[model samples]
Target: GAGVSQSPRYKVAKRGQDVALRCDPISGHVSLFWYQQALGQGPEFLTYFQNEAQLDKSGLPSDRFFAERPEGSVSTLKIQRTQQEDSAVYLCAVQRGFGYTFGSGTRLTVV
Candidate 1:
């Protein structure tokens, strides 16, 4: 991928349903990050992975949220038993030093 790409750009889920969002990071990027952005708020780091290793996942709000970068390139974020509070944009970024490229995001709406 030339830059980070996220699929569906938008999603709507019923409460208690599960949803999965996808991200394709820049080719060969070693660092990938997932963030959650609520409306009018800055992105908060949800997890980070270096290559295929998940170095940190402390920011995930709950056990219902999970992320992985199996091949160290593309990643997926899955939310189980979605709640109304889960309605927000899920952002993906690939780190290149202090610079990171961000995807437009998948807006998940749990109604």
Candidate 2:
């Protein structure tokens, strides 16, 4: 079984630009989640999905953030009009019972 993996592991974006971060979750996992972690802070849940259904997205910070798991396995987070405040680690995790397996994350830097 493959563990969750994220690409780039880092990103730098100019203000007002857009960026896309990718995540590949563990095979056979049915639940996935996205979270944003700011420096010196805990991860804040951004969105969640079960299979192909987006069950919750209330934690998305703003309209600039969008996420999707169209095929129920791979997921992506897109940020539009990136801002300096959006510079943070975007983490993807897959649920397994009481625990979750997380990716290293894409560290976005907006300058």
Candidate 1 regions exceeding 4 Å error are none
> What lDDT, from 0 to 1, does candidate 1 have?
0.92
lDDT against the true structure, each candidate = 0.92, 0.92
Off by over 4 Å in 2: none
C-alpha lDDT (0 to 100) for residue 14 of candidate 1: 96
lDDT of 2 by residue, 1-92 (tens): 14999987999999999999999975767999999999999999999999989999999999999999899999999999999999999999
Q: Mind sharing the TM-score for model 2?
A: 0.95
Estimate, for each residue in 1-92, the C-alpha lDDT of model 1 and write its tens digit. Answer: 34899997999999999999999975778999999999999999999999989999999999999998898889999999999999999999
**Cα lDDT for residue 29, model 1?**
87
How far does residue 20 in candidate 1 sit from its true spot (Å)?
Answer: 0.5
